[model samples]
Target chain A: MRDAFHEDLDKISDSLVEMTRLVGSAMSRATTALLDSDLGLAEGVIENDVQIDAIRDDIDEMAVQLIAQQQPVATDLRIVVTALHMASSLERMGDLAEHVAKVARLRYPHKAVPPQANATIVEMAQIAERLVAQAGSIIAAKDVDGAEALHADDDEMDRLHRDMFVLLVDEGWEGGTESAIDVTLLARYFERFADHAVSVARQVAYLVTGEWEHKRRVGAPA
Target chain B: MRDAFHEDLDKISDSLVEMTRLVGSAMSRATTALLDSDLGLAEGVIENDVQIDAIRDDIDEMAVQLIAQQQPVATDLRIVVTALHMASSLERMGDLAEHVAKVARLRYPHKAVPPQANATIVEMAQIAERLVAQAGSIIAAKDVDGAEALHADDDEMDRLHRDMFVLLVDEGWEGGTESAIDVTLLARYFERFADHAVSVARQVAYLVTGEWEHKRRVGAPA
Candidate 1:
């Protein structure tokens, strides 16, 4: 049987996992919105970000309340503090998704991503979804191995980012400066989304293994 | 007389101010490097980021240790919790400055800011410096007014960011796709740096007034 403090911690953890799910869905839809230029779907992702922020607020309040009431020490305290950080990362992921959706909206009926970079954007979107999904599993199960595997997914995202850059600078590239700007920003959003997912996974791994380096500040350092 | 916990909190607060200083200097130097294409200065900013990371690690350890040893509750606990979030924002500001510096290095021997957009970049960098400097003052003084004033500075940042976009997409833009890409990312880095500064200020202000909204999750939400 769990104590009240542990119960609160579990709820916070559960909320975090729920956050991962919502953020995952957010990015998944935002990716579709970007590629398909679906205005309504883009609007939905932008509007729903508030829900993610609300969950973060709840987690923040819960963690602070837990600390004041339980006065947990040592590892328990670390868990609470780290939960705040993870909540933060999750919230930022939601914002990044919103940014993607807004980009789609800005372009309207025209697709934000051009043809040369479509495949890479699609793959990045897929990996972003997988990363956050795996981040959910990692948090729920505290699976360190799952955390270790997330780095590879992030690596692929980085490679796709580089490929996009190459296309942007290519001599034969048909996309004009305006398209290039949109693509560059879009690519960065996906890369950062994947990064935050990996950060969440790494934090979970560290909390489980008691081996956080504290150096993973900016979501895997690109 | 201040108790041991307050003393520790003071030290943590001091470190946050120090972080603002480091991050401020970093942005100042990064701007110079970007404009002048100074390889050595850019390299210095990139290398010195580790020190910023180290301070954050120190702040993290100090905060968690305080929580373990002090068991602070009520407003005191909120102050400590808010400190951790402030440290995070400052650290991210450091990363953004480093990113700006890296862009400088990437375009070494060639200026990152083109002639058309030079003035805006300079103005953006100046505001970034002021924002961090004021963030330091706000943290040290715990001034609510200082915190409130930060919003205006951030609004200026947003304005500058918009001006940058106008310059980029203008028909008269001569920098081509690559420069547009670089300018877009650099502009974002400065804008985010300012946002984080405002976030730190708001956290300090809230800790002082005991009115933290918890909705300022992603640093004032744009």
Candidate 2:
């Protein structure tokens, strides 16, 4: 019976890793599609997001069932509950990638991102993909160090987001309001994608340390 | 023992309702702050979001404890798990409200939504507040009809969002790129607020009917 419960817990972890992998791939492909104006890849990323959603549902259902059946307490319970949060953040990440893909599709035959903004956007996408990959490793091993590093990775994404915003609103920006909107929204999607990854990493850190330290960083009023 | 379990379940439901109420108030106040450029109200809303976060933590802890201690099965398990999802959505709604307040605070002494877009933003705020209030009632009563009606309310928000976008991109839009970003983001905050309310409502509907819906409506791949 003990072995069975541990197996269930392992399966939950496996599902989370699977979700991270799927979402990471989606972000990478979506970014490429966005950069290259590749409609097929963009459509593929959009199509694959459903799988990410389904996996998230499965992870959630499994976590709930594990708690209900095993009656896990303390650390074990925290791990299961944290899995739920991680799955949610991962699923949202996938949706952000889909948003990017949709934008790619929306502006097909014409790149939504102008040349001036492309480098920062590309770098942001690379950082986002790297963070998710790191997130998967963090989840699989409960690596607190890896989880902590995601914060810096997310900082890079934030800097890029700020840069894109500056470019969009700069006095000399020749990109019209439509392109401005496109890049603005695109930068946000990439930035939010990294934010979700950081969130998932924090969840893992919480699970490992049993201390919810990030709460204060969020600026929640005392 | 059974009665105690049911009582604990009731408490969980109460926390969810309370969370919805806090989020609703925050959105209403945030909107007013945005329109009036009231720094104090915006600060107040930002400060209050911490309480919503605390309540969410309380809900999650309670739900985890209930499952671990009672080992609830079937419908009882579903109720506990759904409450977890509801708490999460409500917490996110609060954060969205806080985002609006932050924007309001950021543009202090200067209006975020220019005169041309003010009416639509105000209407969106009212609708957001109304939906959350209805969401609170729906959670308390588990009213399926009320939950279903939130979809229509959210559709109204979507219409407003589209209108705001069109206005932003219109040839005559004199709001400039900065103001355009402000309104565009503001529109998203309200729309996402409604979307989160709809998500909670759908959770309630799923609880009552045991049929999973709204996943497709989110535009996730099939």
Candidate 3:
């Protein structure tokens, strides 16, 4: 019974890691869709979210069953619970990606702001996507050190977020009302996506270290 | 041994509910501070955050100990895992309230936008606070029906958020760039606060039903 439970648990973790990969790809594609104003790609992301949700449900069911049947103890229990939390975070990341795609669909054909403003957004997106990917890798490898490194990526995204805000304000001052509003919304979306990625990294850190990192003060690096 | 473990679990759940109350009050006070431009209240919210974080840590440690020592089975295990998820969500809710307070501090003494816009924000804040408070009540009472009722409150928040966006854009066309930017950031903060409240509600639902709620579609009523 115990061995069978272990196999079931492993399968659940495998599904969670797969879901994380899908979400990471969805986010990367969403960013590309935004930059290129490709409504088709955005629509594809929106449509693919059902699969992510289905995986989340399957994991939850498996985890609950494991606890009910095998009655996990200590590290095994932590592993199951962590998988559930990670699944939720991954699903939220997917939702944020879909939100980005929706914005792309809404404001297509016209760049939200000047090309320079978008450059910062693109940079933040890259960092966020990489963080998500690295988080999945760390979970798969159970590498505490690799999970810790994800915070630096979050710091980079934070710096880019601040720069985006400053640029938006400067553009507003320079009489770019329409473009500035678009830029502000776009920047906010990317900042939120980064926040969710930080959330994923924090969960991974918790799973490995059993410690929750402090929420970094805005001015400081994570 | 089992009786002692159950008693300890009860105590931990009580503490989790208490922490939820602290976070809900923090959010309410922060919103009022924003609307009144009361720096003292905003500062008070920031200062009280230490207590919230301390409660979070205490609950986390207790949960970990319960899982390690008690080795709870099935429903009991779910309770422990749920507590961990709840603590994390409450911590994030506190951070969101702090973010709102920071905005209050930044735009202090000079009402960044008009009173009308401020009123809308205050409404959003009130709804968010109520939803969080209800989440705490549901957890404390174990009332699934109460949680379901609060579920619809997120829809109200969504509608108000859309209205705020429209107001911001329209104001940009009429009230000039500065007001538009202020409204834009303010909208983002309120929208995020609502999102956190939705998260709290989802956690409550999970605790009651042992399942995840689907992500509410953007622009759809709750």
Candidate 4:
């Protein structure tokens, strides 16, 4: 029975890793589509979201079953429960990507704001992707150190978000109301995406260390 | 030993409910401060965050201890784990309220925008508070029905958010950049707050029902 339970838990973990990969890919593609104005890629993200949602449901079902049958205890219980939380965050990450794709489709063929603003957003997306990827790695390997590092990555995303706001305000001041509004909303979505990823990382940290470490690691030494 | 374990579990639940009450109050106070431009209230929220943070730490510690000692099974395990997720959401909710308070301080003495925009935002805050309060009740009573009702409440917040956007964009076109930018960011924060509350409601539903209910409740009479 213990062997069978362990096998089931392993299967759930694998599904979680797969879900993370798909959600991360969707986010990356969505952001790239926004930057390059690639409606085709954006459409692809929207379409692929169904698969992410399906997987999220599968994971949740599996978690419920594990609890009902296996009656998981100790670390086993934590793993199952944390998987459930991670699944929810992964699903939201997908939804945020879908939102980005919608924006991309809406603004297709029109450049978004100034080059600098677009470039900053792209950088922000990159950070978000890295954080999500690291979260996946921490979950798979239960790497506490990697999980700790994610806090700094999240802080950088926050700084970029603040910068994005400054750019949006400056652009609005310079008479680009329409484009500025688009950029501002887009930036807000990406910042929120990053925030969710940070949330996933924190969950990973809890799963690995068996503790919730709230103090964010300030940025790496200069 | 079983009786002792049950007692410990009760303590954990009590701590969770206490934290919930503190966070809910913080949100209410923060929104009131925003509406009234009360810097003292805003400062109180900023100062009170440390207490929230401390509560979070205590909950985390309790959860770890409960799992380590009792090795809870099934519903017991789910309750403890759900408490962890709820704590994280509540912490973020408090942070969002703090963000609003910060905005209030930034725009102090002078209103950020017209009374029309401010009134809509106040409405949004009221809706968010309702959802947050409902979430607390759902957890305390394990009321799946109440949790389901929050989904509709969330939709109302979404509609109000759309109205705010329309108003902001109209202001952008008519009232120029300054007014539009301020209202846009303010509206975005309130919308995000509602999103977090919806997330809390979803978690409550999952805890009670063992299913991943969509954040949007279906089949309710429009």
Residues A85-131, candidate 4: write the lDDT tens digits. 67767777788788888888887887554576867888888987887
Q: Across residues A42-98, which tens digit of lDDT does each residue of candidate 1 receive?
A: 999999999998898788788889998998877777778788889988989999999
- Model 4: residue B205 alpha-carbon error in angstroms: 5.0
- Give the docking tier of candidate 1: medium
Prediction 3 global C-alpha lDDT: 0.70
Off by over 4 Å in 3: A1-13, A68-72, A109-116, A171-179, A202-206, A209-222, B1-9, B66-72, B171-179, B195-206, B209-222
The candidates score, on chain A by TM-score, as follows 0.94, 0.90, 0.84, 0.86
lDDT of 3 by residue, B46-92 (tens): 88887877787677668766766776666666656666767766776
Could you estimate the TM-score for every candidate?
Answer: 0.95, 0.93, 0.81, 0.77
RMSD of 4: 5.1
The clash count for each model shown is 0, 0, 1, 0
User: What lDDT, from 0 to 1, does candidate 2 have?
Assistant: 0.81
lDDT of 2 at B81: 66
Sliding window of 10 residues with minimal summed lDDT for model 4 chain B = B213-222
Tens-place lDDT digits, model 3, residues A1-222: 448766886688678679778988988888888888898998999899878877876776687677767765656666566667677667777877887788787778754446766678788788877877777776677665565576677778778877866776664445266666666766666666666655655555545544444322221110
Off by over 4 Å in 2: A209-222, B209-222
List, residue by residue over A1-222, the lDDT tens digit for candidate 2: 447667897788788888889989998999899989999999999888878888887886787677667777766776677777778778888989999999999999888888888889889989989988888898899787676666678778878888887888898888789888888888888887888887777677666655644433542211
* Candidate 4 clashing pairs, residues 3+ apart or interchain: none
Query: Better model by lDDT, 1 or 4?
Result: 1
Q: Model 4 reaches what TM-score against the true structure?
A: 0.77
Q: What is candidate 2's CA lDDT for residue B45? A: 96
TM-score of 2: 0.93
Candidate 2 differs from the real structure by a C-alpha RMSD in angstroms, to one decimal, of: 2.8
Worst 10 residues of 2 chain B by lDDT: B213-222
TM-score of chain B of each: 0.94, 0.91, 0.84, 0.83
